[model samples]
Target: MEKIKISKDEVTHVAHLARLEFGEAETEKFTAQLNGILRYMDKLNEVDTNGVEPVTHAIARKNAFREDAVNASLPPEASLANAPESRGGCFLVPKVIE
Candidate 1:
C-alpha cells in the first residue's frame, strides 16, 4: 500500500480557511493524524468488491407504518385558554417588528 504524507503547511492552510488558529504542536499532530487516515483509506481501496450488490436498507422490508388518516383537532377555545393574551378567538403575541 502507498503511504500518505501530509505537510505542516497544508494543515496550517486548512486551519486558516476554517477560521482556526493552530500552534506548531497542534499542526504537527493533525498532520500525522490526517496522513494516517489517508493511508487507511488507501489500504481499503485494495479490497475486491466487484460482485457486491448495492443495498438501500439493512433489513429487506417496506414502509413499517400505519396508513395516514384524518384526526379530530382540539377546539379553538380550549387551545387559546393556555395563551396569556387573545383577541377575537386568536392568540396574541408581542409584535416582533415595528
Candidate 2:
C-alpha cells in the first residue's frame, strides 16, 4: 500500500481556507493525525470487496405511517380569539424593522 504524507504547508493551507489560525505546534499535530487517518483508510482499501453489494442501510425498514386524512379544525374566529391583536380576520403583530 502507498504511504500518505501530510506536509506542514498543506496543513497551513487548509487552516487558512477554514478561517483557522494555528500555531506551529498545532500544525505539526494535525499533520500527524491526518496522515494516520489516511494510513488507516489505505489499510481498509486492501480488503477484498469484489461482488459485495453496496449497502444503503444495515437493517430492514418499512414506512411506519397511517394514510393521511383530513381532521376537524377550529373555526377562524375561535383560532384567532387568543391573539393580542387581529386585523382583517388574521392575527397581527408589530412590524419588524430590517
Best by lDDT: 2
Model 2 residue 91 CA deviation (Å) reads: 28
* Candidate 2 lDDT by residue in tens digits, 14-66: 88999997898988899989988877777767889999998888995889787
Candidate 2 similarity to native, TM-score: 0.43
Model 1 clashing residue pairs (backbone) = none
Candidate 1 — what's its lDDT? 0.85
The lDDT of model 2 is: 0.86
- Leading candidate by TM-score: 2
Candidate 1 lDDT over 15-48, as tens digits, reads 8899998888888899999988877778767888
Native-to-model Cα distance after best TM-score fit, residue 11 in candidate 1, in Å: 0.7
Model 2 worst lDDT window (10 residues):
1-10
